[model samples]
Target: MSKTLIVYGSTTGNTESVSDDIAKILEKNGHSVEIQDAADISVDGLADQFDTVLLGCSTWGEDEIELQDDFIPLFENLEQAALKGKKVAVFGCGDSSYEYFCGAVDVIEEKAGELGAVLLGESLKIDGDPEPEEVSAWTESIMTKM
Candidate 1:
């Protein structure tokens, strides 16, 4: 069984709901999972001891890409998490109408890749409300790949 950690930042609870859904699915798939709010964690050693990490954050701002409030610090100092060689996945919520939909997931995936984290799959970009089926399907795909 793989051990996975889910960290998320949500302003209006969309991303949070998605994170919870993912955790449930992963658990149902027989993986050990831990979920944390980004506000409660620091970048240092954030990915340590976990076989995989799933990061989720909502995108804010109209023109510029603004990561969720609590995720800013983590994004700023992602290298400190020491994720080299670790498996990772990214997901987030955003409005499709926005120019940069789910931009935070892109940024995090890019940075984690730069820091040598192996991406498990393509990210989940939720436009508007999150649906459990979508989250479950995405997570099941990740479990297969993991």
Candidate 2:
């Protein structure tokens, strides 16, 4: 079974809920999973214990992309996470009406790429409320890549 870590930052709980759903699906699939709030996690060597790392952060800001408040510190110190050669995936919740919908996901994906992390699948972006089926499907897709 793959050891997975899911770290998420949420303000309104949308992203957190999505993170929970993903964790449930992964666990049910026989993967060992750990879920954490970004506010409480240290980015240093974050991915070392897990075979795969998943990041979830909601986007804020009107004209530009702003990662969730609690995620700012983690995002800034992402290099310390030692993501190079690790399997990584990005996901988030956002409103489609926003100018840069799910912008946080895009930024995380780019940063992961720069760190030479192997991306498992396309980033999952849930517009508005998250649906369990959609989240499960996305998790299953990532599982296939593993």
Candidate 3:
């Protein structure tokens, strides 16, 4: 079984809820899963010892893309996370009304790829409130990749 880590930054708890949902799905599939709040975790070597790393951060701002406040630090310091060759998946919640809907997920996905992380699946971007069924389906897709 793979050891997976899910780290998320949520303002209204939507992203955290999604993270928990993904963790449950992974656990049910016989993988060991650890979920962490981005505010409480350091980015240094964040992907170490994990077979898969899942990153979630809600998007803020109107005209521009702004990662959730708690995720800003982690995203800025992602280079130190040792993501090279690590399997990575990204998800996030945002408002489609915004110019950059779920933009945080895009940025994270790009960074993970730039850092040499192997993307496990297409990113999951939920507009407004997150739905459990959608998240579950995305997790299942990732499981197949694993």
Candidate 4:
């Protein structure tokens, strides 16, 4: 089974809740899963620990990466050499009314690619709140890839 890390940055717990649900689904499917607060995870040591790295964040301040004030620094310090060949996924919560729906997920996707990580599945975007069907589909897609 592939090991997956679900890291999330949530200001009001929305993204955290979604990340937890995704982790539960992954674990239920017999995959080893680690759920961490994005701020608490070490970008340096993450490369060797898991086969898949999933990131979740909510949009803040006009499509800018949320809670990125901290996570971005960690991500900036990350070298492409550290993440080469790793599989990755991104999921996030955002307001669809915003011009850039799921902008946070997009940021994670772009950065993950720059680090040479392969996307495990399509990025999932939840509007305001994540629906059960959406989460299930996203979880299933990632499991299928694994």
Best by lDDT: 2
Q: Candidate 1: lDDT over CA atoms? A: 0.92
Model 4 lDDT per residue over 1-146, tens place: 88888878887788889888998899888999988887787776676778888888787666454534445655566573256788888888888887877776887788788878888878998898779888988889888877
In model 4, what lDDT does residue 25 have? Answer: 90
State the local distance difference test value for candidate 3: 0.93
**Residue 134 of model 2, lDDT score:** 89
Give the clashing pairs for model 1.
none
Candidate 4 regions off by >4 Å? 63-70
For each candidate, what TM-score against the reference?
0.97, 0.98, 0.98, 0.89
Worst 10 residues of 2 by lDDT: 137-146
TM-score of 1: 0.97
Clash list (residue pairs), candidate 2: none
lDDT of 2 by residue, 3-47 (tens): 999999999999999999998888988999999999999889999
lDDT of 4 at 23: 86
Better of 3 and 4 by TM-score: 3
Candidate 3: which stretches are off by over 4 Å?
A: none
Model 3 over residues 1-146: C-alpha lDDT tens digits? 89999999999999999999998888888999999999999888998989999999999999789999999999999999989999999999999999999999999999999999999989999988888889999999989987
- How many clashes would you count in candidate 3? 0
